[model samples]
Target: MNNVINWFEIYTSDFDRAKKFYTDVFKLELTDLPVSSDRHSQMKYATFPVGVNGIAGALVKMDEVKPGAGGTLVYFDSAEINDELSRVEAAGGRILRPKLNIGDFGFIALVEDSEGNLIGLHSMA
Candidate 1:
């Protein structure tokens, strides 16, 4: 298995605000995707750029889907957790936990996104 997870979706209530929050925090672009499926015709989606060997995911907005915090935590790979942590609040997020060493697993931090979604940041630094 190349990866345990292939795709993921981060639900949002405010599409444009959420998009800007993510883009500002990560310093990367989220490419808007054209809806291709009838089942999801009403949902707006913008995907985080998938690296050559990384998983693909999108931020989604729809009436039925709601974003919440403290559920399943999704960890974003960080070059240095501090770099991203520094921008969390300014980008419309809250740092729930400061960076800490995780023994041999490196370091990790927890944060809440603009959409009230609990997300984790990880790095080996």
Candidate 2:
């Protein structure tokens, strides 16, 4: 197997809101697909194009799912975190923590999207 992460997903309760939030903040177009009969009695799921490549992940809703306090970390190819933070808020996301440094790795901040899913953004300046 190649040492690469092909895709990742964040289950959300509100598909439309999640799609809008990520699209606005990340500026990536999301394609939504109808769930199969085997999944949640036919709920909708969202697929997001990760970065510039063709890789993607499904954002689906599960009845047993709960809001994650902290888990997913997405790194944007940015030199500064403030700009992304601004975008996050403008895109209907709430900032959980301001930008902070983590040794020499870079800066990271936690935010909650419109669907109430918590995600982290990192920039290795």
Candidate 3:
């Protein structure tokens, strides 16, 4: 089988807060999975679709795991990095770094979502 990232999970303290952050910023739909007796409150997760036919991930809550300022770097494709950067603030996210030209590689910007997750945005010139 070809090697590919099937999915990723972001561990957070509050599922509802994280869900709102992601949904507002990325325009993603988050659906909470019903709690089961076997799992109890041990497992809480929500899935996020990155793109059409693309890899997806989930938001999980683990009491043992503490949220960090930096953990993962998720890149999203954008046609207009500048415009997206503007939307970041309105979406309750902060721009860690403004869009910068990367020579032939295109443009990239670093941003922190409302939940404090650092993510990157990329656009091909």
Candidate 4:
């Protein structure tokens, strides 16, 4: 097995609002993905920029899927977790937990995004 997780999706009810929230929080500029004919009319999605070695994921708006604070949690790579934590509230998010040492791993913090999605931030600093 090369990787346990190949891709991830953050489902949202409001595509534009969620897109804005993510872009503002992580400074991510997402791009629209072309949906197949079979799914085009039913859903819409935008993907985060993929680095040369980074994983791929997307923000999806579909009738069956709903975004919230439960289920899978996605931890984003952070160069400065504290700095990001400071911006959470201003970005329309709430800090669920402050940055704390994770033994030999580094530091981690939890936050709830504007769309009510619980997300994690990890950093080595």
lDDT of each: 0.73, 0.60, 0.66, 0.72
lDDT of 1 by residue, 67-109 (tens): 8863234678777989999999999999976785644446657
Model 4's alpha-carbon lDDT is 0.72
- For candidate 4, list the clashing residue pairs, or say none: none
How many steric overlaps does candidate 1 have? Answer: 0
Model 1: lDDT of residue 84: 91
Model 4 poorest 10 in a row by lDDT: 34-43
Model 1, CA-based lDDT = 0.73
Better TM-score candidate (2, 3): 3
Off by over 4 Å in 3: 35-41, 69-125
User: Model 3, 1-125: lDDT tens per residue?
Assistant: 12133345577877789889999998868877543323213656676765575655667674434466544446677777887898998999999767755444466567789997777676764
Candidate 1, position 117, lDDT: 77
Task: Please give the ranking of all candidate structures by lDDT, highest first, separated by commas.
Answer: 1, 4, 3, 2
Q: What's each prediction's clash count?
A: 0, 0, 0, 0
TM-score leader: 4
Record all residue pairs in model 1 with backbone atoms less than 3 Å apart, i.e. clashing: none
